[model samples]
Target chain A: MVGIEPRVTSYLDYATGGFTTQYAAMLVAAGVCDTVACVFGANPRQATVGDSGAYVYDPTYGLVNAGAIAALGWTRYMSKYETVEEDLGAVAVTFRRHARLNPNSAFTEPLTLDDYLATPYTVWPFRELDICKVTAGGAALIITAADRAGDHPKAPVYIGAAGRQQAPLELAGDEHLMCYAMTSVAEQVYREAGIGPGDVDLLMATDSSTAAVIHTLENYGFCEPGGGGRFVREGGIALDGEIPMNPDGGQLSGGYLLGWLHQVEAVRQLRGECGERQVAGARIAQYATTGRWRTDFLSTIYVAE
Target chain B: MPDSVDIRANEANEAFEAFVGDHELRVQQCDGCGRRRLPPSWICPHCLAEEYEWIAASGTGVIHSFIWYLRPLDPAFLATPYNVTIVELAEGPRLISKVVGVQPGDLSVGQAVEAAFEDGPPGATTLVFRVRETADGAEG
Candidate 1:
């Protein structure tokens, strides 16, 4: 029993709702969770509005509710089913067709779906390929004791449970009338990880937009919230399918740091060390985080045995 | 003539003519739970109510969202890209103006605006909202 999820503690009122209430008070100040799991998403100064009119600034159409779009805090659970032009043109055409099959993608050339619908609207249903860019990264994680799995060198993943929820700060004044609180924190993290989102395989969430990663893969019940734009327009979540989300090009082609490097690439694809963005025999991964507009929720349930 | 900048421009032009002699864009309104208050309240933020009610706005509204800045984060707003909105008001409150004549690809979403004011840097005034012509006359 050595689980130690530190995940950034009090970085000076980092303010994205004080960095998920200081990373759930630094996972109960380090003795790693007697119960600590604060989560967050949608942070551009908490979906900005400060020209100071209090809440809801316009200064010329910056965020006029579609539930105050910053990609509705997880793309409003991918708009409960999809259609901001088919979940932003199928994730900017499947990340420009997987950045033409990866080249450390910072945008691997040819993008067209009319260049993701001519880019620029930043919110009204979303544009600029449905948001998420800001970069400058850092990531770290370490959790011990799955019966001290053969004393380290990589091979112990089992946590199997973690759930968090928040939702009220006067709900950002009905944050433009709600819906996507990651579908009740993905129904209490799949009923406290009793597991069954098709018994998971790999997901590493918190996209920050592309409609909150197609409504968090349809709020983690894995495809149902508007069926995540026909489950990513068929092909299910492509890297190989059946589960493969954010095989790294997440945070929109991998960069946005607020997701702690998508939870350090889900502990490097459960330690197989993601060489070509791995995802082979993954055994039940899942990591979720969203806050503010998605209303602060987090989830974790690893298992590589 | 710095007698403390002429007694701070005669106490801010007598608090801007007691808020335009009550046509009321005076703002404060939070007597605790009415909201419309901003940078002036003595305490009330939804029920803390120290008591306030300078209210008057019906100065009209719309816009609801906007952006244009083009790239100026301020070099004195570099040759003006401006626009910036979020109006709302029909007195239910929203605020954050300065739209002017419209351009940044002709900003749509509800349009119609009003409340102007201006005159800062001395007797100080500053409210800024423009893009008008609606009460049915059209042009949003």
Candidate 2:
């Protein structure tokens, strides 16, 4: 049956898609809407090699997504803590292993650290495997007010809290190299949710490049700053580890739907619906993403209701 | 002023670039607090003052971070393995440019650099940086 009346109340876009979903959720929370559909899609295949619309400036022209993010990783990890490039392979390997168990993932081929290292560097510090596969696809989620959430057939995933933090300007502050804004955003989200990093059962960080995974881990308090490379190399983000990250392979292998798939994975994990790639008895899940060069950061915490 | 100039600068940035085009690196200095900002601003971001002036910079800074592009993402930069770097000016603002006259692997954070200019296709002159050499011919 059609609804009594319907209207498109709002529409917007961002460099990152998860923020739009967060905005739609806030609309419902504020009683402005009964339900909101957040849809995200990208078609890099139809465009030229460097036509992503995000990086066309004079200074940033040649530093496309891969190189820009790899530069960030190199500055944070390689320059700061003496981290070797080979240590970054853990993120790709772990995510690929998780993708092997996720039927929805686009690239399910088994990947080992050696196999990941065998690939050529798309950028100096990143291989083709380190970058998200730029494919054409769409994914979406439905957000409803708390009162109407139970009416749905399946279990509802509740948004415990959401928060965003933006830097003053791109590379303006002294801490831009460290992306210090994300730490404050993480504190806000966790405090609002009445939880800590340890309380999170799983984490779904935007894996646009393997560097993003490292940044999220450290910025979200999962590990110390400059310690993300060591944490990943030691299996800290594996499915059976303390904080299972990207259990659905994230954008790395799950296909980059502008982080929409990560949100879906968080919901399914909270609902205990993921058969093999699920974090067992997962209750609280978190999803986080940042804009290019850490211009902004956004995070949302979800719990099964 | 040419139509082929593809920069992301707004009016403020264009004002700053105009000086660079004239072989000068200048920043906005607040008339009140004497604070300086890059890319030019009508108001001082630090003091929130509306009075400001363009002041010539020392044209020297330290390398904040850098990256080497093994593959060219822009057709204009057909040369493979080029570098993009962020330098923190001595006057306290960061600028994005390339470091010339050095191999990609030779640069490090905190290394000192001085400004150099490249006259681009008419009406476009850009700021490129070079490593500051000590009196002993060693990298400073």
Candidate 3:
């Protein structure tokens, strides 16, 4: 991807985690091409997902399926039993602060916890600040042969391990869907990398919604289940925390690139390009996302050269 | 009994349509394991069996969770700012529905609720939830 641009670019609806890494790998896996560009751009005409025009979770379209509403509602219910809402509020505040360091970011204005609480709930638990922004911009990443992935970049980061998993999307099966398909992907990547969660320097975590971030924090083995709320509340996943999660502001404040943008942030961090937001001597990073199906999730880790 | 009407049920949901049209709430039950499932799916998770049968639900449940909407995101839902709840059916399956005859604040975890069908958009008979009252042989 450094020397030449990929000629063939395919169209993918930027909802869930469909477009970014999954499609890129899909293009390569099909054996049709060795390299392809995964590009996502949003504007008025030809509406993209996450935009106000494309928030079509109606019966006609299928993002908010039968189990989705229940999953979200259950998250909200459990959040009330715990301080997860406070954790969500803290993610908004932390990421907005991180956005200040990201000039390419949308909504760079600093936010406070009071501001987050005052924001009206779009859905019951997910407030305006709890979700990603309806952004209009383009993010592209070229997937090429690893051998040819050298030249032009500041410093190249290698794709250490990649893993994905899809789970059944029915409400009748599980009591709750706190983490989506994260556990399967986590196991795959950790095994591939030959390291555990302790070795990860930072996670360019994808927070499609604030509640999702808390769930991922717990279910992804960053902490034990029911520990996510406490982890966020205590600043354990903050900018300079023990795990240093979502250093790029994630989707909460980073503007929804459907989560591909978090990888760009990961690459930049690994290359030591981020000025104020960079984790010190950060050698390893994890970028993860969930697909259109509520339970189809993927995670890819990167190692700095 | 709030003016129930028929909906535009899809082919995959024909079995469900027929049952609900008869005013009976039901789900696909695994013939092998007797486990109930939503979405009227073909396969059973427990027994890995392909064959299934429909079983009538108790029409009674608890409000497992809920959310209040303030927008007409769905034009079909005439009631704006409505409350949607995930009801845990007494038979052990769950379904996404709304709670009528109650406001958002009145909802709580593990509250007893019963099912009620209503006339919904697209001519679909939408299943709804309502607060179940205790019978003490006296009026509150």
Candidate 4:
């Protein structure tokens, strides 16, 4: 932060959904500024569950983001492939389990596959467990040049690569349901980082819905498209599996700080500061987010240095 | 529909609203590329052509995707377990609307659907879809 003195020469504000931290880091890398502070806060608790209820009513269509995502999830995955409830439930259950180890997480209780399945569907094909809890909070990140990092007390996580893409016209076309934009961004970031899915030790994905976790894995090439359901169900994303995802519990069980928390967790994981939930010998960490209604997608690779 | 006056309409979508008011379904057809797009836009996405015309749709399509809400996200939605569907028009564009004349469990992808309209608040009318009847007179 430039502080009350206002010594900073330039200021850039991002109202553009998630990926705030990554974009801020990019500014530092580009020499736009020696340091940048990215701040985020959301208080959608009342609006999401309250009087307005996150539903956007056009003259004819009454649409909610959660409901639309649920429909898209089923349309994209279940319609074409043979998938079970466990395929989707695994994401919620695993996140809650990881949350049990995260002291900062509000959702401390253990969630089993059965418990997830028992939850009622607020929207068909999406249980209450599948959606994120609307919480009010603030998160901030201080991104500085690599040379400045040596002055800090804590180990710095270097930004290896960053990529973001906005879907054409926000909500037009089938890209939102199909993860076409997500794949494009993921490929760009992975290439820039000179690594594949196998090289990353941890993945912190913004899980606004369980369906998002499944889609993220597929879009990032962690697994084949349409195979995410089976991969997650088979424990590929578990803590001891091939790739540990959302070790700090992600948005499903972690507080939904509009994806800022994922960046925070990714940095912390690469720094090896997480206590019980930490992945041993972690080097490369990946953080990703698909913006509200899948309108945009972003990925960043962070490595311990 | 909730009457909060929060309708998201502008110059780009005005043509669609006028057609639905007249109980007809139409989409924007690019004059240069012979392609169609909906939720009405000024330029063709495929060709970036500025000139376009509104042409009547066949009013027939297949159920592309759908979902049923167990509870209304907005209080104005009167019924429970109501379905919202996206219909992929035969002319090659998708529209978000509701499908009537069938139960939620019975509705499936690829079912034949045709355009239907309902009166909305004031001058506006809502565009919806219904399952087309099969040759034997059964609901499609």
Candidate 5:
């Protein structure tokens, strides 16, 4: 979605798909433009809906999709005894721990898994902790052509094959809700980057909610489709685990910028600027973002140049 | 059915709510291919048929999925730990509603449920569901 503002600056905002900044960056690298800037602002904490069941997080889609997340959990991955708290709770807290390391983050307080599980549900299958906080802020990134890249101070992080994929956007129509979207996105990125998931050194996926992080692990083939719960429970996504995902604190702890600020985290890591969250000697990484969980968006593979 | 169901966001949904006002569950059937759908789109997604027939639903299906909102921090919900659900209507369409006559915590996935109607926010009537039965015994 592109928005144009007529003024002294007169610069139009080019918002692409999920992890949209990468798409903008890809365009600039391919001569689609001379330079591109990606920025985002959000203040969901204050967005109000009417006095109906529609939630403040999203007055329109949140209520319905929250139920869908519940449905998907019961039918696809979980048993009746295992609630959303069992798996998603841990993931939420893990991101919280990461946020503690990120001083600029909104949720910097350390959250134990027990405290997260104890929080009452704001929406079912989603406790208040399971959802990213209501952050009111913006972040931006700039991408320029390789020839002009020398003008920048830091080493350029090359954009490899970046792919975007989507599932059936129709309401409640998706088959296998667990693997509907991420699986396809994974396939395309591997083909485009000439590398598979195994080669990536660091990982980042949608953390719109902890459930999303679980789905991303399975959907991205980090584990089997139904294995996300186990993968998460066993500490597969933690910073010290096999794959360090969202080490810069995901949207859950980092604050929500429509997951665009993740690009900033990714860029900083690639530039070796993240003093503490840095994946040791990280040369390759992959990340994804969604405009909304209901449908399509971009996933990018990055390599240090 | 409640005396207060007056809000229908669209003419098509206005018709659907009319059925709910009578304690009847209804869905749109494609006039062309006979496929049924819910959350009324006014047209059949299957065959591009603008024409459809509103048929009363079986008002019976198992719990497709559910969630329990544990607090009323948001004004949008009134219940502490409100039970929200997705009922897979026997006619093959999924409806987003809540428990009408069943205990919220007792709700389980794959349990049988049937439709019910009640007032929501004064002039609005909503279609909700109740436990029709369970694997262990009969419920509402």
Candidate 6:
């Protein structure tokens, strides 16, 4: 009851996190509404027994007799990115970074870059770290009129502007999976918000895949396309940088609960509730939702005084 | 197994057939404001003009950008990594097509390309394109 309706159900088998993120971001940017409630879950009981007791849960389980959700993540990698190595690389980097600061996170042990590189490949491009752990949790939000937001217990956060855009849905038919959609959405969002990349204070994006976070930053006008990886390497998105990103450890470090937690965290930041992880003097924040193999996206801008 | 099969065309796609008959790619261009329409339009996208004209494209251009798919979203194109490229045609229009006959790593920005059609199920032919070597003997 705290968020929007229709739930924006996406078949995990056919849909990508990028698509869901973009859908949420665009809806907010278009002024249709500000604030969205995102929910993500999987039935771990539907998982299949694999090597080392690891289970795979299939999003299309009732429809398709595949493995567990973990297996589905593997198949997505095999069919989408082609190599498990690349997929695992994305997962490992995200998890290792997130585990350092997240107390509620499921996997909290410190992971070295070498441990991530050496983790067994669950799918060619995906590893245990590359895939999101299938957990049962639900999250919600309240998106209301920004001007009248201060009436609530939390201070009002203004949704300054938002943008949504997509490429052809079919991955094979898209111009490029690694680029395109994010850049287009970013250009439109910046135009609508009437601000430049340097004006942003922080970012809360759907980090389903490592490439997704990097590419989205580039596409959102922070950096040029293909420069996302370099941005991460340069610590550009860190807490102390000119533009901070995913201060809450994102979906990678924070468990996956659709993207509802992202919205909640953004609100928390606007209200100055985040301890230690807070970016000081933060006033404006950006959140990007991406899907359809990085070819579809939506972005929203928020301002809090 | 074949990756995809084209189904029969419906009445809404008769113009697509005329394009195949002439071996020309035809898109509706708005006469009122000179905007090229895609997905076929009944009215001009820019000025909402009911009037339009059929224009033939030169079908030659450079690859403005591209991406290689290691995995197949469609069961049909699963075995091979397909290259999807955006071609900036000589007519100043951009079209999306599969870049055939090139390795994924070999692709470069501004690569020259040409459009081609793949015959689909009865009366339906999908447009596909391939990269071409440059006039100066440079392979893209």
Candidate 5 local accuracy as lDDT?
0.68
Q: Which DockQ values do the candidates obtain, in the order shown? A: 0.07, 0.44, 0.30, 0.45, 0.31, 0.04
Better of 5 and 6 by TM-score: 5
Tens-digit lDDT track for model 2 on A235-263? 99999997999998877776677677888
Candidate 3 error regions (>4 Å) = A1-10, A13-34, A45-81, A172-176, B1-12, B42-51, B71-78, B119-124, B135-140
Please give the distance, in angstroms, between residue B5's alpha carbon in candidate 3 and its true position after superposition: 27
Query: Tens digits of per-residue lDDT for model 5 on A71-180?
Result: 34434345423434578877887888888888778777778877877787666556666666556677777767767877787888777777776666455544334546
Q: lDDT tens string, model 3, B1-140?
A: 54222221243277786666566788788888888887666567677787777777889998766766644434454454676677888888877777888765677767888888876555477677788887973211
Candidate 4's C-alpha runs over 4 A off are A1-18, A42-59, A170-172, B1-12, B75-78, B120-122, B138-140
Q: Give the Cα lDDT of each candidate.
A: 0.57, 0.77, 0.69, 0.77, 0.68, 0.57
- Misplaced by over 4 Å in model 1 are A1-68, A71-110, A117-128, A131-207, A210-247, A251-261, A264-266, A269-272, A278-290, A294-305, B1-26, B29-49, B57-85, B88-104, B108-140
Residue-level lDDT of model 6, residues A66-132, one tens digit each, is 1122232333223333243433353345445644565555455676667777775433233445445
Q: Which stretch of 10 consecutive residues in model 5 chain B shows the poorest summed lDDT?
A: B2-11
lDDT, candidate 2, residue A70? Answer: 46
Interface RMSD of each: 10.8, 3.1, 4.7, 2.7, 5.3, 11.6
User: Which candidate, 4 or 6, would have the higher TM-score against the true structure?
Assistant: 4
TM-score of chain B of 3: 0.78
lDDT of 1 by residue, B1-140 (tens): 45764564455445545574433566557645777654343555457666566666667677655544443322233454555555666765565556665666766546677777766455455566777776687776
* Residue A134 in candidate 5, Cα distance off native in Å: 1.8
Per-prediction tally of clashes: 27, 0, 5, 0, 1, 29
Docking class of 2: acceptable
Per residue, candidate 2 scores C-alpha lDDT tens digits across B83-107 of 7777889998888788998876788
Q: What is the DockQ score of candidate 1, to 2 decimals?
A: 0.07
Q: Cα RMSD for candidate 3?
A: 5.7
Q: Which stretches of candidate 2 lie over 4 Å from their true place?
A: A1-4, A15-17, A46-54, A59-61, A66-70, A170-175, B1-15
TM per candidate comes to 0.35, 0.91, 0.84, 0.90, 0.83, 0.59
